[model samples]
Target: MLTDSHTHLYLKNFENDIDIVIQEAKKEGINRFILPNIDETTINKLIDLHKRYKNITYPLIGLHPCSVNKNYPKQIEKLFQKVKNTQFIGIGEIGIDLHWDKTLIEEQKSAFRTQIQWAKKLEIPIVIHCRKAFNEIYTILKEENVKDVGGIFHCFSGTIKEAEKIIDLGFLLGIGGVITFKNSNLSNIIKDIPIEKIVLETDAPYLAPHPMRGHRNEPKYLSIIAKQIASIKSIDIHKIAEITSKNIDNLFFKKNQNII
Candidate 1:
């Protein structure tokens, strides 16, 4: 069994045939999927998907960094109103994305800090999305004095130094299709980081691995990622599966069980 630590099945990319996509993933041994919310607009879709696939899907609620804008406070209020009564696996896909628009940088930071407080209050983990703003994100995390509830750094493509910093902050590095890219420096960093600090993800409908590069990603493609990690680490695929599976089990599932 493989766990996709992060994915957005609520997106329009899977609108037409989500059932079939999920069935195919199960058939491929990609059983568990952790879905992260993008914004208030996607919450209903996220809840719908979780309700439909309760056995295989886990829902995480949060306002994504890129979605942070001038009306972000209003968006966050909507999110909190929706989530206040429920228990979610995490608060996530939240961080700064300077790669797209820098105008909302401070707004994104404010949103991130607020969400971190929510996560701490709820005693849940967080899934962060950082793009070209690692330094700022790290600074906010530090200022918040974040500890205890570590989270996943989704689609991690940072340098070894950055990886170390995140790990030191009690976060796990999420590895996906990028690690399978021949030119991706992620492969080199993965070689040095402990497998215990890694979690597998597809970031589905995006970041498809080599061989399937350019094709729309799906959770079923996770095996290819596991195989690639095994090759890079010079370990057997089963061992890769075992280690990553255990890491995810601890991070998301928490309860002890034989996932295989």
Candidate 2:
């Protein structure tokens, strides 16, 4: 009964054995997975995954920030059409990423703002992909005034100050395999943060946790992250699962279930 708040289950990385990978993860109690679209190229695959596992696979539609190049406006327009026609779990895996290329900084900002605005208009939550552009992302968030929409800051590796700002903005920090890294320092930063503002994610086929480090990640590794977080907070693993499960559900489903 855990959620991998952010993952790319449609990517070719998991193409060879997606079924086996998913089945194994279900055995680990990682049931639901939120799959975010990379761009137009991935929409069909994402839809197929959701169709195959409707209950367990939640699909979100959006043009990823990295995919926000010169042709992004047209891409967004197409995605908007999809949004109008159907319901999406969220609007995301969208934001600025300076890690790869900085030339498209302004383009990324524009794309992020447009998607955020769309989220506000649709009353859907967002899944942000921020990498080395916290200030830029924060500035746009502030400018857009995202008061009603909530989201998960996927693969959050920001500072305590940034964490405070994110929490203040009504967003949850998406805890992933990075938390289990030897020097991630995320363990210390998130320990004091309220558990209610945290959610579990693997960002799988990518950032796997320790012991599984340097290996191709999968949704099954979410249990490792959950166990590590529990040990970090010195709380029972069930409590971690309980709180995070609710946190993720609230982020996407908007239900205010009591976390007890």
Candidate 3:
């Protein structure tokens, strides 16, 4: 079985035919999905999806870096209270994103740090969302010493050096549709990284793989990504599924099996 280590199927993009999407994904052997919250506005929907697909969906709670602002402290406080009585799979899709705006860099850093501390306190892993702010995010993670809980660098497309650094810190690289894209550096990067340090994800309704690149992404398309990884790594597709699914079990389910 394949696990989509990160995806946003709770978003409105899938509202019209979510059941079809889930069914199709299962047909493709993509059985597990890790859903991360974008912000307060998405928490209810995220949790609702988990409830609806309790057997296959895993939920995470956090504030995305792009959603960070002056009022983040208040937002984080409210989110903490919402999940206080319950257990979540992890804390994240949280980190720094400087691609769109640089105005809230400090705010993003503060929010990321706070969530990391909470993840440590909660004894859960974190799912990181990093885009164009690796240095900023890396510094904070180093200071926080996130090796304690371990996590995944969601949608990782970094260099060999960066990948090595992340692996050294005890984190898995969250590989996704990007690896199948023509001209993408990710394929070359993955060749050097060990399969044990990687996990598959679709990041759907986004980053759909080749041949379906322009279309809306679905968890079912994860098989296309698996095929591409198999080609790149010179292994069978089933082997990709076996190794990556084991990686996910080790990272998310094995430790939190009782609570999750």
In the range 116-171, model 2's lDDT, one tens digit per residue, is 98888887888899999999999988888886888989899989999999999999
Residue pairs with backbone overlap in model 1: none
TM-score of 3: 0.98
The numbered model that scores best in lDDT is 3
Which residue pairs clash within candidate 3?
none
What is the alpha-carbon lDDT for the whole of candidate 2?
0.87
- When sorted by lDDT, best at the front, the candidate numbers are 3, 1, 2
- Cα error, candidate 1, residue 166 (Å): 0.9
Local distance difference test scores for all models: 0.88, 0.87, 0.91
Who is ahead in lDDT, 1 or 2?
1
Ranked by lDDT, the better of candidates 2 and 3 is 3
Q: After superposition, how far is residue 146 of candidate 2 from its true place, in Å?
A: 0.8
lDDT of 1 by residue, 1-260 (tens): 88888889989999999999998988988888999899988999999888888877888989999889898888888897867655588898899999978998889999999999988887778999999999999999999877777899999999999999999999899999999898888898999998899999999989999999999999999999999888888988888888888887777667324322
**Candidate 2 vs candidate 3, TM-score winner:** 3
